[model samples]
Target: MASRGLKFVNIQEHSDARGNMRIVEVDGGLPFVPVRSFIISDVPTGKTRAGHAVSCDELLIVAQGSCLITARTAAGLEEHRLTPATGAVHLGPGTWLMLSEFEPGTILVTYASERYAETRFFEDYVEMDR
Candidate 1:
């Protein structure tokens, strides 16, 4: 999920006596395009999710709260502890991603180039080739 180009971005939060707002950039890089955007919320503690890959690439942003994403690839291993203020991470095709230790109200915002496909692999390190 967040095993690839997951880099931190700095964003300004607009907050007043009423509430706060966060703005995210939806732009993308070459070989990856934005086909859709969505959010995930209401995650429970000590639970893991996002055990899939894509033929296309994706960008994952922590819309709210914090969580850890571990991506294991033949290329190597990447782990991210993300907060809402954090930037986005790009997960490329053939990469395996796992989400765990989700703090309360952790919202995941994602941009994808392709619709969901089932041929992508689930996270399994030993069974894969780099």
Candidate 2:
């Protein structure tokens, strides 16, 4: 189920020529808000995470390493192949995201507008749409 077709997810990039280091930040001030900030890592190769979406909006970045993030919406599913030193990926409500194709040591940093609530739709994509 690819939903219908995702609108399109952005994969930001940050670079530093000094030591050849790039930093990605999801700073405040956007159409959405941020209530919590966290990172997800230690995922096995080819394993997928991101079983849920935010009721408001979400900002994500690849803190370290790299992986693939797919945004699934009622419109369709859009794939964003992320890399280290990139900017944040913004996701909105009623969106199902799957983080897969990890390159080992892949880390995902996320910013949300809500607290960590298990009651939120982590899976079961049906209700997420409704």
Model 1: per-residue Cα lDDT over 1-130, one tens digit each: 4444444445556889998886655452323557677787887877788765555676777878888988765467778798876666777766677788889888888777777663355445343233
Q: What is the lDDT of residue 73 in candidate 2?
A: 74
| Clashing pairs in model 1, backbone N/Cα/C closer than 3 A | 1-97, 6-89, 9-87, 74-130
Q: Pick the candidate with the highest lDDT.
A: 1
For candidate 2, what is the TM-score? 0.69
TM-score, candidate number 1: 0.71
Instruction: Score every model by TM-score.
Output: 0.71, 0.69
Write down the lDDT of every candidate, Cα atoms only.
0.68, 0.64
What ranges in model 1 sit over 4 Å off?
1-21, 25-31, 117-130
